[model samples]
Target: MTMKRIAPLIVSLMAALVAVLVVGRPEHADAKADANPGAKDVIVHLFEWPWASIASECTNVLGPKGFGGVQVSPPQEHVVLPGAGYPWWQDYQPVSYQLQTRRGDRAAFATMVSTCHAAGVKIYVDAVINHMAGGASTGAGSAGSTYNHYSYPAVPFGNDGFHHCGRNGNDDIANWGDRWEIQNCELVDLSDLRTEAEYVRGKLVAYLNDLISLGVDGFRVDAAKHMPVADLQNIYSRLNGNPYIFQETIEGGAGEPSPSEYTGIGDVTEFRYGDVVGNAFRDGNLSGLQNLPSQMLLASGDAVAFIDNHDTQRNGRAKLTYKDGTNYALSEAFMLAYPYGTPAVMSSFTFSNPEAGPPASSNGTTNAVNCSSGWACEHRWRTTANMVGFHNAAYGTGLSNWWSNGGNQIAFGRGANAYAVFNRGGTLNRTFSTSLPAGTYCDVANGDISGNTCTGTAYTVNSSGQFTANVPANGMVALHINARTTGGVTTPPTGCGTVAVTFASSTTTVWGENVFVLGNRAELSSWNTSGGVALSSATYPVWRGTVDLPANTAVEYKYVKKNGSSVTWESGGNRTINTGSACTLTVNDTWRS
Candidate 1:
């Protein structure tokens, strides 16, 4: 079958299936492209936008702006929170797997997906499977499906799929130390699911496969860290292969699952990158970004880097303040230029209260996301948007000719295809080696190309590979060789391939035992000791153990703590592994792997 013939057939099939499943029309081809990767560098998170609005944005703004994909809010039926003023978290509550929510119904969602796909912009759904609504009595969701905290009638999940909250509603995760409880226990009063069950896995897979059949490219698994690694692996394996799966595991420090656990199944969200970039930009410390290369090298392939996300924006008591729009723009632009994990930029509207929803009307309907509506479309800013073009032009490239003042000024070449300078200090006037074939190129940060001429006051790159440009305070400059000129370096090196590592232990405990315990200190280790190497620690109550490993190597090691006069491991002999290079160990049974 030729590409032309296969395309229509696929669309027709999706339309028919979606029509039969629910009373709705199929999404247009352009909406489907929101998750599929095209020859672009940007993926806008169209928060709370309806399918119709999204389709329009693709044709009017995203397509012309050079966006590769769009991560849409959860499309599944969710809790309708009227008390919280219908906040965005309402989507976090899963009433059913049906494609119906605040954004649109099943038909509208399908149409949006197909429409985006037609425009060469992929659609990635934010899959929230960790838990149901925080606190809700009635269970008729936005899709009209009946659900209860103890049971979901539409999906028909029973007690086997849930875990009861122990005294104080903690479930004793600190004591029992079981993966099952962590996944099945309530999170912030939200009902969790038992993903390990084959039936549950099948349902999840079916929902995702339905989306894939509708032309979605991947999913953003929300609250993934709270789930079991094995269960996630199982669910992902059952879903359509080749779909982009980015798990949300907020591991900031050295230890924890390290995003490596889920890398085999799909890319994991790198939450720490947001903090690093946000802090560096806000403080005007460009040198803090110099260590990005090191972090990228450690991230391997599972890193799904991003700026401020929904949770972080809601929880202001966190790192990298994103309330400031200027700093947010600088951070996003920097991420676009830096060679890091698979990048996903945050496109959000302005909000005064942390729990506030996107710009909404008096009737509680989400307002259309437009620049004039007080929504900070940071992704559309001149500097940020141009950097997206630069990123697309320099895809698969590595950082070369890195030049930094070790302070508030930095510049680097992206495989000679593009070069960028970030000056957080005062105005910057520097002549840097672009490493591009001598030719004039358009400064993407400032302007566009038209009829072989760079329009606007965009800085120009001379034929000598030496371009002197001034980046005003809190501003940046990026020059792309392919923006207006031809014949520049296009190739990049292929680094070492990745590896998959799993950890197992003799104990079937929910949470692993505390292997290390000191006065006011405790440590835990969960490694797969059956296949990989083992880790040993000294028997010191107040002492901690540290381990270092290579990139892309998977090994399991157990933890041992110092007792009064002896060393002891977790009671269940719990074992864990580290998959990446950089990791840390802290107290309180926390293995910052």
Candidate 2:
């Protein structure tokens, strides 16, 4: 049989295996291999760590901690705010996509990528693609690329590449209610690119593809909600077809674009989490914690969850701050223990003030991340790192037998492999159902288990699935079915015998549903379908017109948009098509690429 004919059968068999695991009550089963592409549980947001240091951290710290990946600072060259003491926000501005920056030169960055990938830790680049540097006049970026927004001679980005200020003007972003104006207009005097244009898309793709070629796994699209949803979709389609695109849409309250707009295309940062955790911790209301797992269950699986990010740490008032020290550690520990949207824990250094930069050299380069300089390497905290391992081990599991007092104590089992509890109330004793095979397990938060026994405060689960333990005031506890005295499962899942493919692109307009048409005579050869048979496209390269996809089976696909020949793929390698969406001759891949 041809490759096309056999591909569907392979996918079908895999899907069936996954279904049985998801629905059947199997004993001590591991996570399904193809569960979620980026669903390894713990992700470390290595704020402001230079590339070289990050590469080492991934190898020595993150890899051993069982973290799925690391979200690095913006890798692109940005404006250097010397007056601000090279504050972290300086990197938020972009002059060009040169690999040369404070993080390290191109060579250093390449080494970081290769080194991290070798250790099984994926690198998610913080891509500031929405706008250029906020205040740039010298045309020369830190990477030595000369770029004047008016000229941008080094990048050859002339007036044609940018969007002109609207009638409202550059600083009028707060006044303009339309998303187009927010995206197209200059953000705080920054240079805004016209992502809809073909020439612009090509340049952005060239930069992103370069990173992908260097082994970068995905992107955290900065200021995503500022751009049009359609535009982002188009850009994503053109770039690396379905590369990991996580949009930074700060949806704080009710009046913002729902993560749904971007969820169809790629994972989006769920900013509400900061507020949820902040309010819960500050108010000392553990009942507030009860709502979290349920809320996360409602979130799309691709949602990127975080307790505190760089922006929140600097701007949000009620949000968790590094200054809080121990409180921050406790909050992060709870975040990791609870299964939510894919979690990316914040790691930071000490700063006297919010505007302070990382420990820096007189020459202006960012210093290494250190705890002694008052930097709170929250990831290094025992509870935090142990939870990271717990998350990895509980990867495809759902919350079962959840127990919460509607106050300071909460506990739940992740699948059957792990169980955890948090005590925010004053010290107390309680008996709860753990659902573990009646045996002794180490409380991972205190210490790990060893040789059928736990080291520190080992708890025994009676035949009734009840275990008694005391949760000290402002403390936490965890017990894993399988973990060593000093370790838990540290390996991420590698799917069974399937080669993965990803798409990288600059803008979403080219292959967006709104842009392409059936009669437009678009070339659709770069796209392919996996679950069933026969996939075709119309004018839009990203649109998968119709196919005979298998019922209740998962599929993966990629697209190549026409703007200077850009290619994009799904964030994860697969998406399940429920039986309701499948038919004999027609099934639509409407869940974006």
Tens-digit lDDT string for candidate 2 (1-593): 00000000001334334434433332222221112344454678888888888888877877666676788887877666565577666777666678878888888998997676545577788887766654334535677665544445445555656677665644435544555566666666666767665555556666776676566667888877767776666556544323456777765334445556767677777767767876676557766665574554237476777778776676654377667765676778777766678787888877656677787787677646444565567787788887887776676777777887877677788867778887777886888787666666677788754454555787777777778999898777787655633223422222211111212222245332222211111122223321111122322333322211223434433332333234334344433323232112223333344
Q: Model 2: which ten-residue window has the lowest total lDDT?
A: 1-10
TM-scores of all candidate predictions against the true structure: 0.72, 0.74
Name model 2 segments beyond 4 Å from true.
1-36, 136-139, 169-171, 252-256, 293-298, 369-371, 448-455, 484-593
Let me know the TM-score candidate 1 reaches against the reference structure. 0.72
Residue ranges of candidate 1 with Cα displaced over 4 Å: 1-41, 165-181, 252-257, 296-300, 317-322, 367-369, 458-463, 485-593
Question: What is the lDDT, from 0 to 100, of the residue 489 in candidate 1?
Answer: 35
lDDT of 2 at 83: 55
Question: Which numbered prediction scores highest in lDDT against the true structure?
Answer: 2
